[model samples]
Target chain A: MKEKLTDSELIAMVNGGNQQAFSELMKRYRKMVARVVIGMLGDTPEADDVGQEVFVRFYQSISSFRGDSALGTYLTRIAINLSLNELNSRKRRFLFFSVKDDEQPLPDLADEANVDESLSRNELIEKALAHLDPKFRSVILLRLIEGYSTKETAEMLGVPLGTVLSRLTRAQDRLKEIVSKLSREMVINTADTTAKVKVKTELK
Target chain B: MKSKTFNPEKNIGNFFENYDADFKPFFETRVMARIENMVMSYQMNRDFAFRKIFMPALATLVVVFVLAVIMGQGISVQSLMGWTNIDMESAIASSMGY
Candidate 1:
């Protein structure tokens, strides 16, 4: 899908001390990196931060690459690993209990914005995506969200095509279920609120 | 063969319909900034390598050339000018057989 300088050309330019070529490589893979970050971070501000860090890391180590994998695949793997690390650290700090600060436990998820209410269609899709585990989510994002073909996704994730297919199918099914559940809840909540309001008015 | 239902394309399209061009724009600047940062790092690395390698190599060559010239002048010119001559034949014979 990408057409421009080949990996060898870019590597040569980079080794030759050509900053412009390095810039070109960044432009080439920026979207791919951003998508992978977004998949893991679920549209948070941190996705961009994490995505930027991935490229920075990639650029730092570009000289050491042995050309075993495609450059794009290499960058994506770095992005995925970094994004997962960020997510894990955030969860540990925020989601689980901390003994150090016992002054009023952190507000439950109820205090956080509702995923179903604030999310746009794309955000809803992303929110639904948050339900799947990272392995499946990586494959799904690469295949469905990023529109990479099956073979491409397999290559990117370094998994067999069969594995990609199965994981993607499962991931899609899981996302569909999550979205349906959220939509149903929204409807039920709206109906319940209306009913309660009507009953209170009649009593008054 | 219970029932095959749900079009994959339709579902795929639904996912794409969620694509946020706005979000994409927000990320573009971020990505470019990242690229710039990477480029800066690469430049720094290149600078480091040049200093670490090429500069030292040049320095070594310069030192070796100066030493070689000084040694050559001290030995070769004195011998050639015969400023401290010993018998050449004796010198050759002694050096050969000594």
Candidate 2:
């Protein structure tokens, strides 16, 4: 069965121009790729597009893949690179338009049936992540969220191990600060809503 | 009141572990479709290049080579650069005061 094929087998089939094999490969690694992309870029449409581009790039270079690294690692590398590129362009756009970072809209969560506690928490997490510098963000996502080893994260990012360690320390410190601030704002917002509701009920 | 401790590391790990990072429904189908479109476009561009650019350029090269050979000039840097009439041996000898 195609599902039982190893990465090397799938890669060989793909190199032989088997589209179905490539599709199977994509299906197999989509979650891993999605996690890296979405973690780095947030759950924006650009993340989705980058997710697709990762596989497309692999397909284009199938003939030369050589299978030195596992397919998952290779795809994660592409996702990270593409996500960083998206982040750079986002920085450029923000600077060019002189847009206040806070004015940027929250990621859409309307499709969910219940946009309650979990939704807000996720939104807070995303906001906190968005505040990180891309370099720090990448290390946090890979080392913490995706649960890759620090050395693995460094290899994937093409950075030295010491750099990853230093970045991880700094990134964690910055993330704690950002998350604390966001959590405080969330608490204030909830209290404000409760007070407004109490007043409205009393007026009625 | 018991104060709650904030641990970003544990919170981040827990949050992302439960996070559904899956793409929308039929994402694989969409990706496959895009790959097909890309492959088709690449093949089309390659074909177009072979037809419009490569073939004509190759034909021109062959024609020029044939013309050069037929005219007995051969295909050398001198002949191609319009220096076919120069007598390099005698010119070099005279320059050296032979």
Candidate 3:
């Protein structure tokens, strides 16, 4: 029965202190929130926490949710803001610790021979995304990945439309470079492994 | 040069359209749990604030009001500041030697 209710209806129920209604709303929008949060922060535990936080914040402010925009868009705006805050704190931690950028370990590359292909592809996507500045990443995720228009992206990020457009261009260029670099590295790693196998076979 | 063919714009769009980020099982349950915890803590904090800070503050204000009324001063800025006996016009005139 709750599934048939609209977002505004569920919001009204939630405002009336219906926790079940809020749960229904969460079930409705969890994927949208997950896309934004996971796109920005990658698929980490922190991303999960941030995803929960987006809905929690919405529930807290449900009374004031005037339905000025779509519920998905409002939750998305919160997700982006919280993700950016997480990124800022990550930057601060990196700076305070003076950690070398390269010293940051890759996601489980030690068993490259046994790694699954699709998993590696997703990892590659994430690594390339990590190279982008948060500003550019937000644009890429919103504009390209999540398929929001330039105007919507700008509004979500609280930037000018021109800024979103420019950032989208630069982010695409950077991602292309990073993806190409990663592909080359993958090819080289394969070649090195093949050469090692060949040398061992010949020696045997 | 191979990177030129790897258009991130088209590829990432296609990839992410099908990409379900590792959404954990029981996501709604976990989110609801967190919300419940948050609501619980918020109510606890509010109750604590009312008891610890607000109640004492209200009591002090009431005491001050009662004392003021008992002393025949009522409530005014001067009376609150214990400045009830000063005549400002004459005091200023005398200070200025008028």
Candidate 4:
């Protein structure tokens, strides 16, 4: 009967200092939170830390949680905000070290050294997404990875629907650009290596 | 169909084609461990606030009372606040057990 209790009931128990109730809430939303966190933070230890923080934050403030949205959406919102906060803090720390503070931070993805033919399609997309600006990346994460409807995505980000659409277009364009660029370079390198191998074979 | 060209970018979606991260075993247990740690830390903070902050504050209030009693000029907690003296004559007449 306790397992069958609804989200409201679970939250009430959590408010009463029930640790198991909190754990149940975590179990219910863990994967969705992980998907959003890991999609932003990558498959690193940082992602796991952020994922855990999201539930902890929700548990701490469970009393203020008036169920205006589905519990999943509420948790997802926290996950997204925390991920962006982590990013902004990283940028601030970088700014503190850099000499030219006047320059606007350009949106660049991660180190593409991980970009190679051996990577699977999923790994490639994940890697490519790392290069995208956080705004555009959120669009891809929410739209492509999490599969939220356009309206829902817009609501979550507090942006207009048109904004979400435009961001999606930009994100897809960037993704295509990065993927195509890497794919081309890899293809060319493979061709060049093959050509050298063939000439060596001829000499032999 | 005139043989569609192989554009690597076009097949980008195919990379995630049939791709999803499988659920790792004991994922819930791992998450719960983190939550439990957070809860314990929060409790410790509350405990610290009571011991480190509340106890000292209570001690200061007790010291204020002892200092006021030693001075004995009707040295109530209110006197330290620089409040205007109460009109005791008006107070006694108003409280005539009516």
Candidate 5:
């Protein structure tokens, strides 16, 4: 919305310590970064915190930004890296907490009310995303969801373009498999709704 | 195996598109605030660095001035430590190096 300035111009302004320019850069890419965070971590509150950390880190390092790729791509790469690290640490913490509190009940219904079937779809995709290794997940999110070109994805992730393509292929396959499994489960659950309704009506 | 009824790639893309409509508006604000905070913090740290260096230097200069006045003028250590301004000529003459 800020007239889509070239990355070089934005980089120049940021290096000159222009706070508003940095803010403008953020305004352009925050949604994309949040989506990447959510995609990597699934819609958890931690995503918001890590998403903020991502941009902060990007701002801190904007001076080092060379215009090898688009600014969004560069920032996305940083966001992905930080988000993955946060996700790893969170997973470790959860394991530790779980071990300490073996009897704690994990909540089952996270999103029960206002059941946008789309919400479930998002959750299913998120679950599948959680299954992939972080490296593959980064590529998949950048290319598929964020619509980065293969060359751009490779540069952003600091890998070869072929690696991006390969990982993208594998990630797509794994994601499809996960989504299919989830779809089947959703179908089975929906299929039993009539019987559940009849039982509830009978009890009433 | 279960019958392959769907293309997973297409499904994945479809899943993204399905929820894409729900993207909230404050996304840009969130990112901008993060960037601003980061730059602001870095600026604060640099300012702090300057202060940290400057304050100690200023303090050292003040200390050297106080010490030079106390010792260079042959003032008694006791009176200098006590913050008492003794007679400089008597103090120097008594020491026999005036």
Candidate 6:
């Protein structure tokens, strides 16, 4: 019967100090939260940190949940806000250190990634996605990766539907740009390694 | 070089469509433990605040009542603040028989 109860029912129980109900709620939605967060944050430790904070904040504010929106949406909204905060702070830190985006560029980031023939296409895409600006990456995460509707993504981001649309277009363009850079880096790195091997063979 | 028309939405889907978000086994345990700690700390804070603010006020009220009865005197915010408005003094003196 507990398993059959709706999100509102579980929330009511959680408000009444039922930890099991809260755990059930977390189990039900943690994967979705992880996808949205990890998509935006990659598989870094920061993603794990934000992922935990989402549920913790939800637990803290469980009493105020009126069920106006789906519980999933409510939780996803928290995840997005926290992830965006971390991204914004990171950008500020970068700015404080006088790191300009144009000066740093995507290929430079890809040069630091684990690129080899052993890497899958998915891994390559993930690495390419890391180079995307956080705003555009957020659009990609919510709209394309998580497959939320445009209106839903707008509501999640607290932006206009048209803004989500335009951001989606620009995000796609940026993703393409990064992937192209990634591919070019892949070629250059492969060639460089091969030339090194040829020189070693000649010396031998 | 052959130019490729980049389809972001489709490619993003391609990368993440089969994405599996696997949590370490301790994730749920860690979260539940944190939630419990949060609840405990919150209850502790409420109890602490109640003890901090309410107990002293209750004690002061009891002490004031006992002293007022013992001394046959009036207790009032006006008298406490040493204000001497005529109407207030008369009303308070009449009310407290002091």
Instruction: Identify the CAPRI category of the predicted complex in candidate 1.
Output: incorrect
Compute the interface RMSD for each candidate structure.
8.2, 4.9, 4.9, 6.2, 6.3, 5.6
In the order shown, the candidates' DockQ scores are: 0.13, 0.31, 0.26, 0.22, 0.20, 0.30
Stretches of model 1 off by over 4 angstroms after superposition: A1-33, A54-116, A189-204, B1-17, B21-64, B73-98
Model 5, B24-60: lDDT tens digits are 4575577676666765788899899879998888887
Expressed as tens digits, the lDDT of each residue in A120-140 for candidate 6 is 555565676677777777788
RMSD of each: 9.2, 6.2, 6.0, 7.6, 8.9, 5.7
Lowest-lDDT window of 10 residues in candidate 1 chain A? A100-109
Runs of candidate 3 with Cα error greater than 4 angstroms are A96-121, A184-204, B1-12, B49-98
Ordering by TM-score: 6, 2, 3, 4, 5, 1
Residues forming the 10-long window of minimal summed lDDT in candidate 5 chain A: A100-109
DockQ, cand. 2: 0.31
Error of 6 at A124 (Å): 3.2
Maximum-TM-score candidate = 6
lDDT, candidate 3, A112-162, per-residue tens: 653433336656667677767778888988887778899999888889999
Q: Compared with the true structure, what per-residue lDDT tens digits does model 2 show for residues A94-113?
A: 87675544234332333223
TM-score comparison, 4 vs 5, better candidate: 4
RMSD of 5: 8.9
TM-score for all models, in order of appearance: 0.55, 0.72, 0.72, 0.67, 0.64, 0.77
Q: Which residues of candidate 2, in runs, are more than 4 Å off?
A: A98-121, A184-204, B1-15, B53-98
User: Which runs of model 5 end up more than 4 angstroms from their true locations?
Assistant: A1-20, A95-120, A159-166, A194-204, B1-52, B58-98
Please give the lDDT score for candidate 4: 0.72
**Global local distance difference test of model 1:** 0.67
All candidates: TM-score of chain A: 0.67, 0.79, 0.80, 0.76, 0.72, 0.78
- Candidate 3 CAPRI assessment class: acceptable
Model 3 C-alpha lDDT versus the unseen true structure:
0.78
Residues B1-98 of candidate 3: C-alpha lDDT, one tens digit per residue: 23324555466555444545656899888888988898899999999999999999999888888888899998997777677576899889989999
lDDT score for residue A116 of model 1:
38
